[model samples]
Target: MSALSESRNPGATRSLQVVATAGHVDHGKSALILRLTGMDPDRLAEEKRRGLTIDLGFAWTALPSGQEIGFVDVPGHERFVRNMLAGVGPVRLVLFVVAADEGWKPQSEEHLQIVDVLGAHGAVVALTKRDLVDEPAIQARTLEVRGRLEDTRLAGSAIVACSASTGEGMEQLIGALDHMVGNAPRPDSTGRPRLFVDRVFTIKGAGTVVTGTLTGGPIAVGQEAEVLPPGHRARIRGLQTHKRSLEVAQPVSRVAVNLTGLPTSELERGDVLGLPGQWRGTSVFEAWVRPVRGLDHPLTHRGAYKLYAGSAERDARIRFHGASELRTGERAFARITVSRPVVLDLGDSFVLREAGRQQTVAGGEVLDTDPPARPGPDPAARLRARIGLDRATLACRTVIDRGAIRTPEIAVLAGVTPEEVAAHGAVRLEGWLVAPDVLQGAAGELSAALRAYHSKHPLRPGFEVSEARVLLGQHHRVLSDPGLAEAVLGSLAASGAIVREGAVVRLPEHRASTTGREDADRLVAAVEGGEPTPPTVRELVAAGFGPELIRAVCADGRLVRISQEIVIGPTMLARAEHLVRAHGAPPGLTVSGFREALGTSRKYALPILEFFDASGLTRRQGDVRLLRAR
Candidate 1:
């Protein structure tokens, strides 16, 4: 079996490596890959006819050291720069090609700028067509290329002079690639796999298939995945890497997935496939951007710009921090608003191109994908503090900023796992991770609302829970979510900061106080003297006993308010229950029968029975009452 096929076995140990090519048009990028792998990098019919690369092409080969690596050959024409970025934007290791006779050209400079912005993990620069140049000419061209690499991330990358036609220096070029691939760092796997689809096509019998670089984690066959932007779900029917069938595709390698659920009509290039809920899409985000070196004009908010990241390209509008415009070399914080929602994460690099001018202008690292609606004063400073923070610290700060957030939501909002979020030591209540100060503030606000409620309705036992929800909703936006709102109130109760009773909530110190007031005693006396048939609330109000005092007496257990109009003494309530038990048998007790037993009219007896029914003390059957078993 071939080396690429061997890696697909379960016991294979060597991880696959990927390399993307960068250079000017017809500078032997495709030619070098064809010479190295014995497979043509230019796959399109027009590309072979015109002797030019029009789009991205793929080829793979085993290195001299038995390491399997793949090459993404990209077009070097300025018009196809979008396709070139799609190839190189996600891969970290680069194989830069420059013709020895022609030296550095315009597209050469532009491609280098893109590689520098994306920040390669390792690179090998190939100076092709060495047979066309003299030894002195080759040395001079080497020095010219070295000048451009002085401060770039690819500064120390080896530059090999070779000829794809004659195979000059081919062995040295192979050795450099082997060394670069050997030392490159492994891709971090967080169990959240993301595949940015660069090419989408339907197979005759395999259905829809998409090819892209897999990162963040491994994707196994039969696992469910979601296609983002529209978020249609599908199952992975099969997996392939370098045209070899595999049960699972590893990260930092090229992968093609055959999906079962969604059709090719629904998916397109730039769409993402991942585990459901692993990625969140946002149109607005904050970033730290710096212009590319040697721009002829200053970078301003005005211009038709396109933002490129992974395989996705979006129309974007940018606003700078603390300034109206930025010079060629100045760096500043910026807020980018895309034309539509796209999946972005922290520290992901993107390139900005001025479409009107048809040139790449700037590149930036994403600082925050979910920025605040109104960026307050010195928002730049706030973002700067977060620039170098670890994931845990950033998750804690995000929780603090949101005051109270759903625990699982951190994974969706910031890509921080639940365990990482828990390690920060934030307070979690009812699945909500809350900031310490915000929790304290929420308790205080609830207490204040209860106090106001008690003062306004001193006769009431406590604040009604329904009203409390509405009142708290006005104070804290978190209260608008029913689950989160109940969580806050429950946490306060758990901490003994408040008390909850059935449908009401109250401060711990609250009480229905009519103590030592003359109206309280008078109301009780009037209710007791009236016996089974007590005076109506209208009569009590007419006698100068306010409705508030009557309600206070009722709340104090001195009186039972049977209805809006009827108020009875506690003695009367007990007497009615006794009569119901005595007469409640066989046919059950009727309102008139209880009325005569209590020596009251039907008007008072009807409401008395209803109050008993509401309290679960009795069950009503049509017009008769049945005694309930305690």
Candidate 2:
């Protein structure tokens, strides 16, 4: 069937990406790949003459079942380990190539460690150059390699002896790869299309073009896409997979796209192309990094490094939390702050190299693409929080449990296809959805806290909204969903769970008792009879009342603290009434004038004036205060 026909047919299964071949220099990796795919992957003349791949190469083969399998031929040289890492990020299967004559090499082991770190779904070992080794020698070497792989994730993977020159085991290698591909999971086609740009250049007539194995979703000609980090939008003018022009390309297929509108200067090999606004450049992320086993030095904080992910490379600073130094081969949670924003999703694989030395130090999976700003205290706490959310479903639930999880954040944390998470629930394209239970639980906690607070400070008018946020801590912003919090507060008030007095929140019982008490009565009497002066806290306390009770009365609006020694209750009402009648309107009163009017000193007058400012009884300007409208 035509590629397009196979993509559309219900019975035709999606293809798989099988990344194979490893070992230091001249292992016949390229030759074996050429024999399998019948396509020369080594296009560079330097690679042809040197008989080794210096960069990543791609080739494809159609299996007996009509399923297409793409292979990523990565350089085995120690210097190009970064290139190997870049190619492994999007692959599901590994074709580990070991030369029978050369046995195992350093780069081969390093490459295998990288494949394990990347979490390849499956693997097949090719013992190439079998013609150079006798049958017994080949068998012994293959067994030794198998023993070495026993403790690894690729332990039980199929191993086949082959010679690219004689093509002895070519059919067997194809069969093994095909079998693994059939079992590999299919990529989700739903969501945003993201192609990690592995190769970028201008075709003779196609303008700026980029090629990479389609890692997620599908892209079609004429579809609009955006280049990330730099964030330039463009349209797909052409599409090709496996060197054949096609209308559309699906996941696991090697695709080259000719783009329009984006200048060649604006595009780069690492820049990811995706549906506009589907992905974002991330500055902060949480990762569970493992240092390469058997290294002498420990991973240190603020250590500069080069980070590689899906054909993208950038400089970054690593902050190792929970410990000052990460021992060689030790695993720890780390926060990576990139020098600039890069398009990254949750579960994406990344390699870290020592900044200037360019040696692979560590590699890890992304846990969070955009983590909340965390400063001070134990950095390990943030790491643990991320570690607990390693599972996709649990992570998704945690986001829901926390109230709102951004779609992009969910995609980054779960490592599942972005489209799958986006389809799991109907969330606002920009805002996340909070589960009803989470919202209800937060509201309940808020109400209980307010009630407890009112019980402790009966004289206080209510709880301020800002104070409530401080008390809630991490749940603060999650609950501060504008009218949502207010609605909960209102519900509590209506149910007598709490009382709302302006901006203050109080217990219903406390508001009633404080306002009806005799201290309130005595305060009113003292203020009205004492030459229009307000009663102070001390003066009110002397009248068989506590300072707390006096403050409560003032907060209830039955009395006002006009001065330190002079508290007014219904007394300001009379003065306000008199002033309005005599002057047509109340005049602006200075601290001196307010003191004279209340017959108190400046010390007593200042706080009372400010109290009026808080109550909206007067507006302060410079040193003067004006009576406010009722």
Candidate closest to the true structure, highest TM-score: 1
- TM-score for each candidate, following the candidate numbering: 0.78, 0.75
Give the RMSD in angstroms, all C-alphas superposed, for model 1.
11.3
User: What digit string (tens of lDDT, one per residue) describes model 2 on residues 1-630?
Assistant: 112223332233244465656666678788888898888878789988977788888888888978877778888888787777667766768888889998888877787777776677888899999989899999899898998787677999899999999989888988998888888776655356778888877766568888886766777777898888888999988777775666767776777788888878988777888887677888888788988766678778857898877777888988876777787657888889888788877677788888777677778888767665753376556455655443445455445545565555555444454344444442332345444455556556766776776655565556786665554444556556554455545655676766677777665665645544555576667766764444456765776677777676666777765655666656555564354234323456677766676565676567666765776767776666766767
Shift in Å, residue 542, candidate 2: 19
Residue 492's lDDT in candidate 2: 58
**Clash pairs of candidate 1?**
none
Residue 325 error for model 1, in Å? Answer: 2.0
TM-score of 2: 0.75
Quickly count the clashes in candidate 1: 0
